[model samples]
Target: MTTNPTLVLGGTGKTGRRVAHRLADLDVPVRLGSRAGTPPFDWTDPAGWDPVLAGVGAVYLTYQPDLAAPGGAEVVAAFARRAAAHDVRRIVLLSGRGEPEAEHAEAAVRAAGVPCTVLRASWFQQNFSESHLVDPVRAGVVALPVGDVPEPFVDADDIADVAVAALSGDGHAGQLYELTGPRALTFAEAVAGIAAATGRDVRFTTVTTEAYAARLAAEGVPNAVAGLLTYLFTEVLDGRNAHVADGVEQVLGRPARDFAGYAAATAVTGVWKP
Candidate 1:
């Protein structure tokens, strides 16, 4: 295998980390682009960008927090400019489906004159095991503002697979992949799956957005995180992301992983236990 080093931005994060691992497994050289990596790359510090991009042929861009946050597009645009200046040839951006700001960031990458593939993804199934929802599930009750809205929560593994293919393989340039799971599930149903898989009495509680935010704040979650959660649950989870997409299969030539399978596998590890 040729050693075309790829820079994985947010390489320590949910999806980027997995992508980096997959690339490494295939004998591809990967440079982790995170504040903690050697020659650290901090999104808030533009000075850290050029060094990370140096000699990198392809980049997997996973913006921290989210690409939908305030000023995220500007930051992504600036990073793209720097990547181009550093002679980066390809960029695969991890984007959010249905987010206007994410679309703006995608446009910026496209304008950078490099080969770009946009993976516009839905919510991740790993949110329950690896993110904010983990503690709530461990506590036996997961509360949120979304009620009855279905979401095809894509697995992070599948996102990483698609990302690795786009970054390392051919025929993905100029493509926009809307990545989602094979099926959609409501929050209640999703929690029920977890309960069944883990043999734990986990419950899902629906509340108003304000109430959910207050609860999160009371739990010592930072204001920005709480606000972002509120926005995701109330605005993004309101039946807008209910349908499944074929981007995963389109990119990987295989069906995306199912959420129930993810829950079952994660349950065996006992990560949701208190």
Candidate 2:
């Protein structure tokens, strides 16, 4: 535990919230950085970041929407410079695997002169249980623009544990950890696992990008969000990240959780039932 509180940007988000909980469990103080948090930290509004950075010893940096969005590197670099100015001792950035923009953001953080660790993770297994896929899973059919490209979907819990270690311990600075599950699975295979765990009839189906976009528009999703989803499903899922990584074991000395475990655990929570 650093003497001062660790600031968790995107504190209410998937991995950020889990990291905050783990740090708190270890008796570390945490300041949440979100739109609803005190001294709200919004990526679009950097002028308000000083208060959030004050007296903070470290930061778990994650961008809203995504770090892969346009201007992401510039924004992250600017914030990193401010963090350096504030004398923040450490930074652990949540990044994405195989994303050029995410890598650029990592480079920016390294250039900021702060001791930092980068976690470049594959897709999260929690997407089915905690995000937009939840509804589709509940509805018993997950339609997407992706096909046979497999992704090594990592557990958010594993990522959280690694982030906590980097934040609270030493020997992690200047390291880039590529976090992934033990194996890769296509979206269909993942959904099949969910179906087996939940004893439900959830299925995955592929659709044309145009059809998916139309569905998003009909559901009232904003055009920007729809575009991001399309890009992720199409460009990012082009089999570029279909391999497993051992960063979880490298950092925490344990194997990363499998998607089956995630689905089984989440199934017990009754979230997959309609």
Candidate 3:
């Protein structure tokens, strides 16, 4: 590993935090890049990025909101350029699977002339336990605009492990890892698994995109956030990435964790308790 610390952007977020912890466990020095971090790294404030990149060997680059958001490609491109200018050894990006905008961002990262590894990950299993679905799951009903389309929800821990390996080890440069779970499950099936694990009565229901959008607007959700959810459900959740990918096993030499495993393990934390 390089003598310089690895800079983890979005360090307080789901995957970023996990990556930072894994790096620390491996005795790889880590520099967190967040608004609350030392020197404070904010994507909106590129002028303040230099301090965070100083002496950094590698970067775990994840954009806030999402790389699919508007202007994200430009921001990532600028940041990548800065990283290259600093002579950073590697960049491991946390990207969404089957999103065109994310592809643009990936292209921008590669264009920067830095050694880059892209982890194009499927939907996260943690979405049920740690994201907007948690409240609905606890309330016994998880409704969304998605139908029976199956998704291979990747574990955040797996993503972090692959990221740490790329950041600290070699042979990962210029690679694009399509990370997903071992199998695909529909939303209803996933909820059923969670219910079984927690002994709860959680159920999944499907709503029209219009109804979901109206609900979000009524609940005071910002347009951008509501729009992102709509895009994911309507555009990205159309069976395009339903198949499983071998990135996890290819990178970590172990099979990806199954959804049932994630649900069972998360149940022990009482995060889904009503």
* lDDT (Cα, tens digit) per residue for candidate 3, span 48-164: 999999999999999979999999899999999999999998899999999999999999999999999999999999999888789899999988999999999999999999998
**For candidate 2, lDDT tens digit of each residue in 1-274?**
3579999998998999999999999999999999999888899898999999999999999987888888889999999999999999999999999888888889988999999999999999998988889999999999999999999999999999999999999899999999999999999999999999999898899999999999999999988888888988899999999989999999999899999999999999998889
What total of clashing residue pairs does each candidate reach? 0, 0, 0
How many clashes show up in model 2? 0
The list of candidate 2 runs beyond 4 A from truth reads: none
Q: What's the lDDT for residue 172 in model 2?
A: 96
Q: What global local distance difference test value does model 3 have?
A: 0.93
List TM-score per model, in order. Answer: 0.97, 0.98, 0.98
When summed lDDT is taken over every stretch of 10 residues in candidate 3, the lowest stretch is 1-10
- Superposed Cα deviation of residue 77, candidate 2 (Å): 1.0
Candidate 2 residue 100 Cα shift, in angstroms, is 0.9
Number of the candidate with higher TM-score, 1 or 3 = 3
Q: What lDDT does the true structure give each of the candidates?
A: 0.90, 0.93, 0.93
lDDT by residue (1-274, candidate 1, tens digit) is 5566899988888998999999999989999998788789998899888888888889999887888888888999999999889888899999998888889989987898888999999999999999989999999999888889899999999999999998888998999999999999998999999999999899999888788877887889888777777877778876777889999998888999999999999999989989
The per-residue C-alpha lDDT of model 3 at residue 182 equals 98
